[model samples]
Structure formats: C-alpha cells, structure tokens
Target: MTKQAIEQTGLIPRSIIRTFDRFRIQLLSGTEKLVIQEFRISRYQVLVSVKCLLSLIILPILINCLLKNFLVLPLTTNFWNTHQQQIFLNSDQQNRAFIELSQFEEKIYFEFLLDSFNKNPAFNNSLSSSNEASISNQAKNKSPLKTLYSDKYALNKLIREDIQRKTSELAVFYNQESIIALTNLFGDVITFIIIGFLIIWMKPQIIILQSFLTESIYSLSDTTKSFLLILGTDLLVGFHSPRGWEIFLELILQHFGFPENEDFIFLFVATFPVLLDTVFKYWIFRYLNQISPSTVATYHSMIE
Candidate 1:
C-alpha cells in the first residue's frame, strides 16, 4: 500500500510544468564547444536581442496603454459628452422642457411651435373673419370632420418634413466622422509601410533569423503551431495587429501560468521579443555556418 501511494505521488501533472523535460534533456546534451562555436558565428546576436526586447515587447504595451487611456478613450468620451447633449434637455430648461421628448414627439412639438410663433396668427385672423363671411356665403364646402382631418394631415406632414431634415443632418455628420476616421487609418498604414520597408532594408538579418526560429518552434509542438497559424492567418486576412493579436498573445501567456499582475504583463510583453530573437540567434549560430557581418552582402549572395 505504501509503495503504491509513493508511485502515484511521483507522477507529475502536465498543467504545473513550464516545459517538457524531454526538450530540456535534449537541449542540454550538447557540449561547451557548441556554445563557443555559436558565439563565434553571431557576435552581434545581442544587438538583435536588445532591439527585439525594446521594439516588439516593451514598446507595444506602452503604445497600446498610452493611446487607449490618454488619446483614444478620451477622444471617444468627449464625443459621447457632446453628442449625448443633443438627445437630452438642459438642466436649466427642465421646467419648460417636455419630459421624455422622443424623436417623433420632439419633431411634432417643434413644427407646432414654429407654426404658432411664426405663421399661425395671420392664418388665424384670416380664418376668424372668413368664418363670418363663410357663414354668409352659405358655403356647403365646410364640414367639421373634414376640416379636422385636413388640419391633422397637414400637421403630420410638417412634422414628417422636420424629422426627416434633422435625421438627414445627423446622418451626414456621422458619415463625415466615419470618412475622417478611415482617412486617418489610411495615413497610419502608409507611415507603417514606409517604416517597415526601411527596417527590411536596414536589418534583413533579424527578420530572417526570427522567421527561421518561428518555423522551427512552431513545428516542435502542436500548440505553438496552432497559435502561430492563427496569428499568421489573421495578419494575412488584414486584421489590425493590436486588436487581433495583442489580446490573444496576452491570454496565451496568462493561460500558461504566467503572472496576471500589470507590471509582470508589461515585463513579459517587453521580454517576449527578446526571447524569440535570442532563440533564433542561438539556433543559427549553433546549427548553421557563420554568415557575413553585412546583411546586404548576405542578401545579394542569396539572390545570386
């Protein structure tokens, strides 16, 4: 009974382990000469590691948080504040204002008010005198029900016109805002494209190294392969990187027993790119032949 209990206790839970023991054992089987060879092949690997750490990991979180909290959130909040006022009556006008003035009711009231203040008096005077004249003329043209129906129909037409005009103006305003937002997004795309091209021109080695590492790691595990496939597919489908990826990556990290604290999340984000770059550098230097210091030379030779 004691032996069976001890054997059962020896079994490790998959969820608690950070990495596969087999992977670690295989990785450590290599000798010290391999490390020296790796170092000789890529001395500038540290630079790439630093660049990835600063750019991919740290910068993204900062940019995301700052833009969301200070810029995007604030801008949207201000928009809500401005637009919300249009739908509700002012506090000072509470006594005079009709309670719960829905769009349809508001339009009816507005048309009625305008007619009463601006045009109804002259028409009423004419009607008052015409009532006496109308009685004298023995006009069989008048019916109380017909008059009431005509007045109601005219009032409804006036209200409909007013509502349509106001709604159309609002639609136009929203359309203008949408166009501006799209234009700004286009501008950002152009800017990023230029920057990306410049980066490819300057440090093609980093891209090549990271790509190779990603491919290797993705093949090593089904989980990694699926995650990377989803990420790549999203990018290929033209999804926004911040919206599509950042949250996904964060969730993956958290699910893998990573700390949920804000500072740790930021640090993880900052360090993740560096980890990838370092792994790539290690693999290239350890497994492959030494390449030239200059990326242009390497690129041109490859093209040939």
Candidate 2:
C-alpha cells in the first residue's frame, strides 16, 4: 500500500480493475548496487519442476474425477434407485403415497368449489342442495372405493390429515439416502480442504525461502554477492516466486482471515464452496454494491 498505488487504484474503479501493480523492495536502505540476471533453466530442471507442480495441483483433480466417474456417481445412483424402489414397493408406503395424492386432488377440487361459491351467486345458492345431494348419493352408493373416501366429515378430516402425514413420511424416506450421501460428500470435501491448507502452510517455509533467495539476487554484487547469488539460484527454481496459482490460494486463505500460521487449516471447512466462495466472493460483491450504482449496473450488464 503505497501512495502511488493508492492514487493509481483510485483512478480506476475496482469493478473494472481486477488487479493492482504491486511493488516490493527487496534491497535494504544505504545500498544502491542491485543487479538481476535472468538465469535460463535447462529442460531437465523444467520437467522436474513441472512434475512437482502437477503433483500439487493435478493429482487431486484426477482423483476427484476418477471417483466421480467410477465410484461415487454409480454408488449414489444405485443407492437412490434401490432405496426409492424399496419404499415404493412396500405395500403400506406406496398405498400411503397414492392416498396422499388422491387427497390432495380432492382438497384442490373442494377449494375450487369453495372459491366459486364465494364469488358466484348462482353457485352459492346451490351449495345447500349440493351438500345434501352429496350425502344422499353417499348413502345410496356404498361401494368399497366410496367407503374408503366417503364424504363423512370425520372420515374426510381423518384421511386428509393422514395423507399429509404420509406425504411427509414418504419424502423423508426418499431423502434418507440423499442425506447420508451429502454427509459423506461433505466429510470428504472437508478432509481435502484441511489437507490442502496444512500442506500449503507447511511447505510455505520452502516457498518463502525460495522467494528470499531469488528476490535477494537483485540487490547483491561483488564476490560475496556472487557467492550468495550462486547459492541462492541453486536453491531456487529460476527465480519464480511460487506461481500465480499459489498467490491465488494465499489470497483465498487470507480472505477467510486465515493467515499462514503453523497450525490447523483455514478458518473452517464446515461448509465447502459456500465458505470458500463467501469468504471472498460476497464481500467483493458488497464492495461493488457499495460502489456507484452505475458501475453495478455496468458490471451486471457486462455479464449479461
């Protein structure tokens, strides 16, 4: 945070400008001679470095993809199908769902009649006859289907309540496997985030060490400087300070108020994308929201 950077940042809206020109001074005061030699890395070193990078990044993605295609997706699908079929095939359970659906239709029809009776004068006049006729028809036609859902006030109320209860029961039955799967998925995600945070925090010692060596190279000279540079270069991988991806991770952690300490992981992994995204995203959204409304409109318009 320098005056120059602040001034420059002020000139452009944060919505449009995603990054700032960061300046870090590697040399100390009272020293002026600083030189940086762009060292070329050999193909072998480049390949080895890339291999390490892939291990850090690609392995997780690969594992997740394989699990999704070969294990998780199939297991979930099979469990869901079998669980649903079992619940449906159960005589009591399936009958309940059927009874529930029938009651729901009856309720809708009754509501429609009620609403019509309210607004239609003719319909209102017919309501008394309709009720009495309905009772008489029920007395005359005593079929099993009619008996099951006869318009006896007590039976009707009881069935309606029972149907609602059964509907909820069926819903819970269907969602049982889903709940378990979600729990397991959530656990796996939390595990990975914890592992990632721990690995990054521990290895940052090496990363910071590498940064120091490479950044220090720009400020030294003479035999001691050359010796230091040679020593430093041998330790660093071509003066590259942990890739942009590394910085991205660090920023993500920081957005969650998780500084690179020597313990635990980020603030929490209780929720996965929700926290990772909210810790960074919604605040940025709030910032943009606080900015000029025109900018907000423009930002959304740009996306649209």
Candidate 3:
C-alpha cells in the first residue's frame, strides 16, 4: 500500500506519466546486454555517449567565450553599476522620459511610413487637410499596433526601421572589435557530422551501444522514481537543508532499506537536476532513434 501510494505521487499526480509518455521506445532492456563474462562497453555506446555529451560541453564553452570578450574584457565587472547610473535606468524618472521618446519616434516614423505608402500609391495622395488631420487624430487614439498601418501615424514604422538599422550597426561594431561571435551552430553541426560518420563507419557497435543506453534509461527510470519518492517524502517531512546533496552522498547506503536518521534535504536539491538531465537527454535520443531510424541512419551514413 505504501509503495503504491508513493508511486502515484509527484508535483502533479500525472507528472511521472507525462514525462515517460513522450518516449517512443523502452530505453533500457533487461536482455540488451547478455552476460557471458564481465561487463564491457560496446563501440556504439561510446559514440552515442560522446554524441550526447557535446551539447553539455559546448554551451558552457560558448557562453564563457562570450562573457570574456563582451563583459570581462570590455567593461570589467562594474558594467552593472555603470548602466544603473544612466537616466534610462532611473525607474521613477522613466515614465515621462518614455512618453516623450515614444512621441518623438512616433512623429518621425509617421512621415517615413507615409512616404512608403505614397510611393506604393495604394491610396490617392489627394486627401484634404481636414481629412488628413482626422486620420492623424484617429491614429493617435488607436492602439500602437493599429497605428503602424495607418498612413498619417507611422511612429511604429519609423521606430522599427531605426531599430533595424541600429541593430545592424551593433552587429558590425562587435565584429570589427573582434568580439567574435562565440556562438556558431555550425560548429555543433560539424561536430555532430564527424560523430555520425564515425558511427556509420562502425555500425554494429553503435547499434549495440545505443541499445544498451536505451535499456539503461528504462531500468534507471524505475530506480530513479523510487529514489525520488523516498527523497521527496524526506524533503516534504524532514528538515531539508538548502545545501544537502553534497553531504547526502555518504549517507545513502545500499542497505536493506533507506535509513532514516536526521533530515537529508540538501543532497536531493543539488543532485536532482543533474540526475534529471541525464535521464531526460538519454530519453530524448532514444525517442528520436525509435521514431525515425531510417532517416537517422541515413544522416549518420552521410556524415560518416
């Protein structure tokens, strides 16, 4: 009864179900790795494990590069303080400033957009002063979204054009300054392509390795859920420390049953995400492999 009730509880009642429902295949299987002698890693498993690891390793690398060039090199560590001293950063003074800026941009854009429409000549450019004024008045009363399309009120149009131009300028400035766009998805593609090719050149090994990972995820899911149930119960009722995962490792004994001493809260919080991500990513790959093996195989072949 206790086990059944524990299995059924999560953040939401069906939280566990929703998580597993997305997977198209059983990731872990009991029969995946036949035991004859001691366990050994397969060729396919190594490739897949490395493939899964690139995203984890690359993102942090890219972010570090970006921060070094833009923040650390350019502004040191006090950029936040610099930005806050600017008038734009003064929240109490910003309301009036924002209104004035909006009005200025609005007037400039109205003329610009009206010129665009006139060149397009969708409407006769022969409207009377009174009619034009009425249109302008209507624009002022209308919402910002509606005002953009209006010929007489082109604030939104002008603002968009100005922003586009300025953003391009910023991009060019960073390029010239050697800030180096630290983020290029092309690197990821190339890394993956090399991996795919390596795997294709070595298929039987890759397949068995993939099968092992799939089986591992399935087995781990059940084990993880049980661990979570016990952990969550402890967290909910026990004195969960803000920093317990670091300490909890030593406390977790593979004895007959989970030992209950004092509260063991900090360990769960720290370790939950790392454990969750390991499960989630493995599941994602396993799911993709199941749904489109032909396509994936072809891709792997080409890259190889």
TM-scores for the candidates: 0.30, 0.28, 0.22
Error of 2 at 56 (Å): 4.9
Candidates 2 and 3, the one with greater TM-score: 2
Tens-digit per-residue lDDT, 25-133, candidate 1: 4478574666677776555565664565466555445654555455654565466556654422223222223332355567587656565545444444445665676
Candidate 2 to truth, TM: 0.28
Best prediction by TM-score: 1
After TM-score superposition, the amount by which residue 281's alpha carbon in candidate 3 deviates from its true location, in angstroms, is: 22
Model 1 spans > 4 angstroms off = 1-50, 53-154, 157-161, 164-168, 185-189, 208-212, 215-219, 222-304
TM-score of 1: 0.30
* Residue-level lDDT for 69 in candidate 2: 58
For model 2 the local lDDT of residue 242 reads 30
